[model samples]
Each structure stands twice: as C-alpha cells, then as structure tokens.
Target: MAQTDTPGEHASVLRLPGIVLGVGLGGFADGILLHQLLQWHHMLTSTDQDRIGVKYYDPDTVPGLRMNTVWDGIFHTVCWLAVLTGLAILYARVTQDRRRVWTSRVLWGWMLVGWGLFNLVEGVLDHHVLGIHHVYAGDGQLWWDLAFLLMGALLVGGALLLQRGGRPLALPAGAPGPDAR
Candidate 1:
C-alpha cells in the first residue's frame, strides 16, 4: 500500500499554527527578559517619563523605581496581535498556493525576516542610544542591549538558512527536476 496526501495537510502544517509558535516564543523572550528582568521602565514609550506626565528620577536618587512589567504586558499584547495577523495572511496565502512547492517555506522565511526587522528597529531606536528604554535599565545595561540586537540578527539569518535548505525539500510528488522549473 502507498500513502496518500490529504487535502489540507500542507496548509495545516504551514499556516496559523506555525506563526503562533514562532512569534509566541520570540515575544515571550522579550516580555520576560527585556521587560521584566531588566528594569527598563519605558519599554513601549519613546519619551522620558517626565515628558510624558510621569515622574522621573535618577536611579541613584529613586529608591523603589525599578523595572516595570506593565509595559511587558503591553509589548506582549502587541506581539500577539502581530502574530495573529501574520497567521491570517499565512492561512490565506497557503490556501491559494496549496500545490506550490515553496509557498510554505517562503511564508515562514518572510515572517522571520519581518520579526527580526521589528526587533532591530525597535531595539535600536527605543533601547539603545535614545535612552528612551533599555533591556535592563539597571547598572551595566549595554551588554543586554547588544544581546537583543544579536538575537534579532540571528533570527533573520536563521530564516535565510531555512529558506535555502528548504528548496530541495519542496518538490511535489511527481515534479520534474529543479532545472525544469
């Protein structure tokens, strides 16, 4: 006996679930480490607390002013929304391209690239030199900040690697050789 392909198996493997898993993992790291472990008060804001009608104090002077996990929740919420939206798009695309060999891999690669870009831009503008935020606002925050950027780069690079490796595995049952396409 021979195994037969199902109607929706490809879409099931490639769509909403995949996006949710990838984005959830990445978002959890940001919420837990960057927003919670590090005392970065303003994780989602672009301005100083004083300028935004919130109190401000030098870490030395302020006694209890430490990391705020509230913003972590907010960041996580946003990440969830992004992942949901990406999942919707992935579902649609995969449905339309169910028979296409590279559709799923390409979709996954694109999502990874988008997530990395988000991290790089947000990390630099909000957490780095602007001082709007930090991965850890406490003492010696530079290394944490660098690590965040490095993680983003790694995500993007890993996606590219997957895209390359996926090509040979994407052929349909009776498809001709690569050169034919």
Candidate 2:
C-alpha cells in the first residue's frame, strides 16, 4: 500500500530552534567559561595580533592578547543571531500551523544532535590532536579535555535515546489524525 504523508511528517517546526539553542549555548560556554572565566586564547585571529605572538601566549601575561576582545564580541553576536533566528522560525511555525504545536522532545532532540556534533568535532580536532587549546590549561587541562569529550558522547547518546522514544504527546487539533489523510 502506498502511504500518504501529512504536514506533520514533512514539516519540522523544532529543527531551527534546536540548532539555535545548541549553538547559542556552545557560544555562551566558550565566551563565559573559556574566554572570560578561565581566560583561554580566542580562535579568531586578526592581522595585527597575528603579527605578534599573542595567539600563542599564556592568557595571564599576554598584554596584546588581553586587550583583544573582538572575538568575545563576535561570539556573543553569533550566539544572539542563532537564538534570534530560531525564535523567528519557531514563531512563524506556531502562527502558521495553529493546528499542531511542536513537541518539546523534537526541540530537545535537535539540540542534542547539534551539540553532540559540535562537541565531537571540536574535542577531537582542537582538544585531542591539535593541542592548540584545552578547556583549562592552567591546572589539570588534560582531564578537562577528557571530560569535554565525555560530555559530547553523552549528548549524542541522549539524543539517540530521545529519537528512539519518539513523540509521546497526542497530536494537536486540526492536525492529521493517526488514521486519516
């Protein structure tokens, strides 16, 4: 038998929000903990700073690197952009598809997948092999890197679980019925 797909099946209302939330949080962690709190080196390099050794110096004693806060601003800007875009998409979906409200599971699942991928790639390339940076290079940085990897694994695993569980809530009104077109 040929199966007919419904709007719910084709439309993903939570996908954009999930991406936004994940990216926003990741940027937040990088800006707050890595940049502000622990004071690690920024990833974005400019021309002037590139000429000097600011990119590869200890955060504590590097004067040229200390004043360079452009990366921090850029990080926050990107985070806000992601979040705003997500919000816009979510709002549009909610208004347009008044019949069926999106499920939290879908949103969370999206976030998990996005975050997991980010963590996995960043951890492997930056933390493991390149050794260009670590979460906390001052004391027990290796352990921190390991923990970061573990966190990434957990996020991916949790997302898999959510995907397996599927949607637990009943479909909203006006949405296609379980047995209807």
Candidate 3:
C-alpha cells in the first residue's frame, strides 16, 4: 500500500505543516526583533568574518548597510514564502475540525519543533559553521550563540514531551485529504 493508505502509520508526519509554519514565524520573529527593532545584527553583518570569504557588508556604513538591508529583505522573502507554503500544506492536510487542531498540543508541539529546528540549524550553520555572525557579535558573543543553541535544544526536547500527552488528531485516517500524497 502507498503512504497515504495508512494515516495512522504516518500520523506523526502531520507535524510537517506545523513545522513549516513555525520556521517562517520563528524567522519573522528573529528578523523583526533582532534585525529591525533591536538593531542587533543584519544579514551579512559578520560576513567580514565569514569562513568562505564573502564580501563583508558592514551595517555601519551607508553602502554596506544598503547591501545588508537588501540581503535582509531577501531573507524575509524566503521566510514569507515558507509561511505561504506551510499554510497551503496545512489547508490540504486538515480537511475538518481545524479549530481543534489549532488548539491541540500536537500542533503546538510540532510548531515548537520547527522553531527549534530553525534555531539549531541557523545557529550552527550561520554562527559556527559559516562564521557569518554571532548572536550579538560583540562582547560575550559566544555566550549568546551558545545560549541560542541551548534554547533550541530545550524547545525541541520540551515540545516532544508536550506532544506525548496529546490525543491523536481526528484527521480522516482512512480517507486521504488533498495532501494525501
């Protein structure tokens, strides 16, 4: 039988929609709060330190800041696309009882899982692997970066625990939704 033939067997996979949503939302939070409001860091802010020799775009200079702003816009666009895609997937997967699904621990857990994954991947790849930027990129920057990773770990672990108590969602287990594939 194909994967869609057994919803029960793939019940956990339903988290995909929530995860995608979380990735976008979490990214928005990061960009809005950190990049805009806090002025903490911008895209390519630390490219001067990049391991791969990316041209640095210093946020302190007009030309540099312009470049960083453009890159930030690109980042936000990607996040926006992720959110749109996530919503489309969610609409297809949950054909009924969306209110309950929205309130369910499972959905929230999956969302947290997505957020955590974002932090983990971004923190590691951007902060550590890519040498792009630190969380604060100043005194005690490593501490902030480490803290970010720690928060991600905690979120993922806590979300998994929370999801354990959730009842299985009332999706059409036998009947595939539009996203059955």
Candidate 4:
C-alpha cells in the first residue's frame, strides 16, 4: 500500500475496522438468511452424543421449536455484539484520523476479506470442529459444510481482486464528523 507523508493518511488506509464490520455483518447475513429466512437449520438442531447416537429436533414440536429458538437467539446475540464492537472500532478509527477515507477500495476489499474470514472460521469451528450445527443439519453434512468454505474462499479471492487497483476516496471537505454520520 502506498503511504502519504502524514501518519493519519497511512493509518486510515489500514482498513481494520472495515474488516471487522464485514465479519460481523457476514455473520448476521448467515444467521438471518440461512437460519431464519430459509429455515434450513438452527443452532442446535443436530445433536450427537457419545453413546446415545445422533438426534434431530422436530421444528414442528413446541418444545423442540422452543429449544431451537433459544439457541438461535444466542447466535443472534453473538452476531449483534460483533457488529456493535466493529462499529465502535470503526468510529474510533475514522474520528481519530483526520484524513480517513470513508469510501476506499482498500476498506471495501478488507471488508470482503473479513466476511470471508467469518464464513471460514464459523464453518470450520461450528460445522466441523465442534460439530454443534451445520448448513444442513442432517446426512451429507460434510458436503454442505465444504461448500460453505468454498464460498468463503471465493469472497477472499474477490476481495484481493478489488484491492489490486484502486485509489482511496478522500473524505468530503466540510463533511460532518463521525458523530453526525
């Protein structure tokens, strides 16, 4: 990345806040689209025990639906916290740096990278390592999980392409500060 003489310009180009926001937003997308909209799977729909084998929750049942709803709420809470934290970091970065560019290619690229990271991490940890839940909480779970990772990889690759050749947009003169925005 090119750097200006001023330290704030360089700092503004870091794009860490954008990345964080992307990750958190990506998580929200997953939770909202996949979990709620499509009704694919819940947080704890597919459960496996050491000796008791595997069990699947019936969404039709009141108790089962309640359990799934609770878990889903927990998942939503985590995603919400991530977004709020990311917004806080972004506010700090933008306000602290005078020359911070709000609409930079690097920032958008990094945000895409963050979303990719969210997908990769969540897919690996939740779907494989922890085996708590998956994209499709039933047989052939591995294929669906692998597909999620592949999509994440695509997002990262796309971000790299976007970041390759673009100049950062300067913040508008006389623009209201982050407090107003």
- Compare the candidates by lDDT and give the number of the best one: 3
Clash list (residue pairs), candidate 4: none
Alpha carbon lDDT at 77, candidate 1 = 85
Off by more than 4 A, model 1: 1-25, 37-67, 96-107, 168-181
In candidate 3, what are the lDDT values of residues 1-181, reduced to their tens digit? 2333443343454578878988898888889988899988987889888898999988999999899899889999989998898888887877665566676677777788888888899999989999777779988999999999999899899987776556554344464332122
lDDT of 2: 0.58
For 48-164, candidate 1 gives per-residue lDDT tens digits of: 532344344344333323433355566788877877766665445343334453444644654575556666776776676565666665567778778878978998888765544
lDDT of each: 0.54, 0.58, 0.78, 0.70
Q: Number of clashing residue pairs in every model? A: 1, 0, 0, 0
RMSD for each of the candidates = 8.0, 5.9, 4.1, 5.2
Global fold similarity of model 1 (TM-score): 0.57
Per-residue alpha-carbon lDDT of candidate 2 for residues 103-141, written as tens digits (9 for 90 to 100): 455566666766776677777766666655566654786
Q: How accurate is candidate 4 locally (lDDT)?
A: 0.70
| Model 1 local distance difference test score | 0.54
Name the regions of candidate 4 deviating beyond 4 angstroms: 1-14, 49-58, 96-102, 169-181
> Candidate 3 at 97: error in angstroms?
0.6
Task: Kindly list the per-residue Cα lDDT of model 4 for residues 58-118, writing each as its tens digit.
Answer: 5668987888888889888887887787778766656544344454556667678889999
